[model samples]
Target: MTPHHGFTPFFTGDSYISPASKPDWLASALPTLTFYPKAIGVVWRASRQASSGRYDSRHWCESSLNIVRSLETVGCRLRVTGIEQLRKIDRPCIFIGNHMSTLETFVLPSLIMPWVEDLTFVVKRSLTEYPVFGHVMRSRNPVVVDRVNPREDLKTVMNEGGKRLAEGYSLVIFPQHTRTVQFDPTQFNSIGIKLALKNNVPVIPLALLTWAWSPGQLHKDYGPIIPSRTIHFAFGEPLHVSGRGTAEHQQIIDFIQGNLDNWHRQDSD
Candidate 1:
């Protein structure tokens, strides 16, 4: 049975063989099992029982906070500063962050939800096909794009993201395009800045220190909870588009790099 959104059997049963399956293989293969599949069916049924209301910003905030609490139990600590700057701004803005680990996907909502009532994100279309996460992501109405078609995808981003901004919801975009083992300036793109300019929203640069939580380790344990490695997040003052021209492009690149430099400096000190 193919795993459907909100329904997967991995968390439900004793049939989860450990040594028989490799971790990476299991993560990729478990969703494809159809014969005598118990977990997928269970998840599908449970998802049906869940509430069908439209995405509630309040619920999103609460769920994110709970995730943070749970991560703390495993030795993950998040140190966030400059959040007050966000509160002073009155309009919806585009939040562009450097992609590092999966931790930011789980923690960022909690940090920004309190200041802004509405929030959504730009996600790869493949994520919409994930088991349980896929359902939750879809319900949130994220801007999903097919990355294979760059021309079409950017058009969709501008249209969908613009609508969300007009609705008073802010968007979080990872301009690095993909998660990297280490930061590479060459991999960065200006699409995020284009989106912000298109929507006429201020661009807020964010730096994520997610290396604190080592992902894809052999140990499946939750890891440490207290005195955990400190993760830092710095929010730069918003950059507003001055005009549609060459200067706009340079400003966007400078905004991202400058904030990253400041964040590293702060980390060193």
Candidate 2:
């Protein structure tokens, strides 16, 4: 379903899957060309809107939806499920997801903001410092962390994240320090769970596979776009954190890991 400022916030179902695509001629890019130019163009345009003070939440989401459509135009299929969970909640919440690539970071706003109010992310400080993209991100008022100092980053998230929740903003946090194709529980932290517990909000597990935009070698994030892989996002029901949140945190981990394992298995079959 196409998302717009005035349309129904959530699609008709708990899921919305992009229809399978036939081979597309546009999917063929020049062998020497990469995805950066196309992505930068989108970001650059959004940055201008933001700088001019014309970028609001609706505009922010629209830009993301544009990115989704742009990817589809190039032959990437999106399979989104459990999106109904976003609308089922009545209060502010925390979202914990496994970080895969830059795609999830850019794509989630459109999917989430329609159902929930004041959606924001806990991003690495560098993201808020990028050239054109940084302007777009800063306008959203995300919780930023330096990522170099664990104690400081924790303090930043807990303090800043707490304030945002108090103001009715939902937080999306990727506990992994860096984007990776493989899921590692040891690397995923309970920071989101802790923040939820502190603010007495629910933590929703967001499991996504965005390897279509793989992590780059030289730039780390400027990488190849693999249209052959289907991008997937699964939103689990919200879990309230209590009693140290041990069980809830584990449930979040299990949810993400289970979906990823199932998706990989299906691809193999």
Best by TM-score: 2
lDDT (C-alpha, whole model) for all candidates: 0.61, 0.84
List residue ranges in candidate 2 displaced over 4 A. 1-6, 29-36
**Model 2 lDDT tens row, 1-269:** 34334656534587887766653554556311434566677888899999888888888787788888777767778889998787777778888999999899889988888766678999998899888888998999999998899999999999999999999898999999888999999999999989999999998899999998877779878777887788999999889888999999899899999999999887678
Clashing pairs in 1: 1-33, 1-34, 9-39, 74-224, 75-224, 75-225
lDDT for 85 in candidate 2 is: 85
Q: TM-score, each model?
A: 0.71, 0.94
Superposition error at 264 for model 1 (Å): 5.8
Cα deviation at 161, candidate 1, in Å, is 1.0
